[model samples]
Target: MPKVKRKTKAKSKGGIFSRFRDYISQYMTAAAAGVTVVAIGLAALFWAGGYFGLLGEQVSRMTNAGAVAMGMDVRRVTAKGLDNTQRNDILDAVGPVIGSSIFHFDPHAARARVENLGWVRVAAVSRLWPNSVHVSIRERRPAAVWQMSGTLHLIDENGVVIAEEISDAEYTNLPLIVGAGAPATANEILRALRKEPALWGAATALVRVGDRRWNMRLQKGGDVKFPETDISNAVRDLARLHDAYGILDRELEYVDLRDPENLIYREAGADETIAG
Candidate 1:
């Protein structure tokens, strides 16, 4: 039986071509994974080195050059409603515009920057097609001269400070507001005084008392103590008294209108007396 043992070929796992194909498939997969890792590492390196930003800038420059060649670049800038806002300031806020692509200009951002200026109440920025950019702004109106800590500032009607260190002569027509928290309450008294042209014209300064009420200093060396409530009526009554008896025209020290039922005043040298 040992002598009769027959030789037989071992069962084949696969054909030679199949084995070669498997080797190539494994090799390709490893190579692909290595390539992916290398690509990610290079991307991180480029980002860390700011190369991505430079590349983006270069691409932008090229795009801008192409746009310029197409005659879509900004060549001029025009602004309206400038008033107190400097033209150079607007140009600076709008960023680089000449020879830049008009389509790349951000109008909303430019408008926001322009509106941040002290005098600009509102602003609009637009790209004029083909070659121009336009900016329009409305300036804040100077309502009063707010004096704080010996420095003068221009304020708008809404009590917003417009500009600081302003010259007194330049804004002499504006009513002067003195003391702390005067700017916040100036509008109401200013409106009330405006109703009486004589009083408004004679007012030199409006001083805030305890952040609650106002004491009006007159140009003729007199003061009017205003009530915390009923400011409009108090101003009207004072104006009426002035019209009838020329009380404000007199050489008076102060007029106390704090009491709604009684009007009291004092001459420069006399004691205080109740008005009839």
Candidate 2:
């Protein structure tokens, strides 16, 4: 053979090195983008942290700045519908954010604290924006002054005791309820009495007799016994009788309306008398 004229096939080196360089370039570009993103994030974090304070303080400052930009600083806190609750109580519930931004102030949290107050039944707290916080409250009206264990309690219509150790002068207009379990049925009896406005006005106290029926003490004097069943109708009947004949004005000890067929009465000093 003529000097073994077989030539080895040349391996193409350009394709391999080109592919390798392209892969390195792609990795470099990705790394550069990742580094740029991290740098931007760090710069933002540092700016917020250094200009403000720690994380919490930083967030607070930013929030206050935004609120100030929008003109939401709390300058006045106005509360309405306050009768029995003290001003300091409400102010204490609102916390110490008087001069701070109202946007960051939590209305819901402030409302809960106000609702916990003894006189507040339903409280509505809202931001007035730009300079004020408004609190509207619905106070619990005293439905009855309940006497338990020789202590009087101011109770709402729902039988919830609003306050204890309150002076009688504070709740002189409320009806007095006496005996155990009287608070639970006080509203019902009072509502029934309302059907007869004259009777309702003339009533002074309600006593739960035997935990079954009610005995109403009149402003004039004496007591009116009401039956357990159809108590409302029984009260109406007594009112009609009082209107027709000045029966309640008479010197009677007790007027029994328990029996629908007949009424029983007793003279102030006499034993017992029955009327039909």
Best by lDDT: 1
Per candidate, the number of residue pairs that clash is 0, 0
**Per-residue alpha-carbon lDDT of candidate 1 for residues 1-276, written as tens digits (9 for 90 to 100):** 367778999877788889899999999999999999999999999999999999999999889889999999999999999878889999998988898898789899999998888899998899888889999889999999999999999999999999979887778888899999998888888998988989877778999999999999987787999999889999999999989988888877889999999999988888657574
Give every collision pair in model 1: none
Off by over 4 Å in 2: 1-73, 200-202, 219-221
Model 2 C-alpha lDDT per residue in residues 1-276, reported as the tens digit of each score: 567678998988798999999999999999999999999999898887674347668788999988877777788888999998888899899888776888789999999999998789999999886689888999998898998778898999988888987776777877889999998887878888767877767778899988788998877788998988888788878888889987777777888888889888876888658685
lDDT, candidate 1, at 6 = 84
Give the C-alpha miss distance for residue 104 in model 2, angstroms.
3.0
Q: CA shift at 143, candidate 1, in angstroms?
A: 1.4
- Model 2 error, position 113 (Å): 2.0
